[model samples]
Target: MENQQNDVKYEEEYIKNSRGVELFTCRWVPLNTEPKALIFLCHGYGMECSITMKGCAGRLVKAGYEVHGIDCEGHGKSSGLLGLISNFDN
Candidate 1:
């Protein structure tokens, strides 16, 4: 994990959805250079983006790609009832 952190740039933020709900987001990119591609990662149910996706995102960043992740509405640092989604289509 320590090796992955070295020379890789990481960032976190919150985005508001149409319903005014805050969603947690994160990204990883190669340090001192632009990424050749962008990838969006999605974690499984009951998993947080930072925890489960970090290693993979780090590797991708090292491989000349930028990786972005988002915690679902009810998971991680997002605001909502745990393990709950109001609608699948939303």
Candidate 2:
């Protein structure tokens, strides 16, 4: 448990879906050599899941889980901005 907190591997700004409005983007931080589980978080609209999610993710990570996130369409670095995301599936 304590050891897991020490090991953190992250791949930031990775793409999930990239059509018109990609519905996902995340900071993948591997918390352990052998994670017990994977934690995925989808944030609120008009906002990315990087700030507070980082804190929550860190705690889960320390508990030996692979922490990940998705910034629903019109949010983070996924793709399209708000007020312009057509009828695309995000």
lDDT of 1 by residue, 11-67 (tens): 888999998989999988788788898999998887789878988988888889999
Candidate 2: C-alpha lDDT = 0.64
| Model 2 per-residue lDDT tens digits across residues 1-90 | 112235776555645464654555555456336888788886765777767587887777777787777776666665666635566663
Against the correct fold, how does model 2 do in TM-score? 0.68
| TM-scores, one per candidate | 0.89, 0.68
- Say which candidate scores most in lDDT: 1
Output the lDDT of residue 3, model 1.
30
Runs in model 1 deviating more than 4 A are 1-4
Query: Which run of 10 residues does model 1 get worst, by summed lDDT?
Result: 1-10
Tell me the RMSD of model 1 versus the true structure: 3.0
Q: Please report the candidate that would top TM-score against the real structure.
A: 1
Q: Cα deviation of 39 in candidate 1 (Å)?
A: 0.4
User: Where does model 2 exceed 4 Å of error?
Assistant: 1-5, 16-24, 83-90
lDDT of each: 0.85, 0.64
What lDDT score goes with residue 27 in model 2?
Answer: 54
